[model samples]
Target: MNDSKPTPSFWKTPFGIGATVIAVAASIYLYIEHRNHLLALLPYAFLAACPLMHLFMHRGHGHGAHGHGQRDDTPKRD
Candidate 1:
C-alpha cells in the first residue's frame, strides 16, 4: 500500500489564488478611493520615522568603561 501525501502547490492552491485575487482587488480599490489621503500622510510618516531611526541606530553606542582611577569616599585603614 502506498502512503504518500500530496505536496502543496503554494501559488496554484485554492486559498493562494483567492488571496492573490483579493489582495489585487483591494489594492486597486484603495488606490482609486484613497490615493490622495495616503499621499498626504506620507510626509508625517517620514517625520516620525526620523527620530525612531536615530533612537534605534544609536542604541548600541555610548557604553564606555567607568570608575577608573577614581577614589572611593570611604577612608582606608593602615
Candidate 2:
C-alpha cells in the first residue's frame, strides 16, 4: 500500500505567510488611525454581545419538556 500524506493548504504555505503579514500590518495601521472611532464603538459591541451570549450559552438548559427549577431524577450510569 502507498503511504502518501495530503498537501498542506494555502494558509500553511509561503503565500499564506505573506498574506498574514499584510493583514497584521493593515490591522495595526487601521487601529492606530481609527483609535477613537473603534474605542467609541466598544460599548455598543458589548451591549450587542449580551443577547448573543445568552442564545449560545443556554443550549443544554432543556427549555422544552423539562420545566425550570426541576431536577432529573433518572439513575446515573457509569
Q: Which candidate is the best by lDDT?
A: 2
Find the number of clashing residue pairs for candidate 1: 0
lDDT (0 to 1) per candidate = 0.83, 0.87
Query: Local error of candidate 2 at 23, Å?
Result: 1.7
Pairs that collide in candidate 1 are none
Please give the TM-score that candidate 2 achieves against the real structure. Answer: 0.49
Alpha-carbon runs more than 4 Å astray in model 2: 49-78
User: What is candidate 1's lDDT per residue for 1-78, written digit by digit as tens?
Assistant: 879988788888899999999999998998899999988999999999999998898775443323667655555454
Tens-digit lDDT track of model 2 for 1-78: 879988899889999989999999998998999999989999999999999999999886555645778887776464
Runs of candidate 1 exceeding 4 Å displacement = 1-6, 43-78
In terms of TM-score, which candidate is strongest? 2
Q: What is the lDDT for 4 in model 1? A: 96
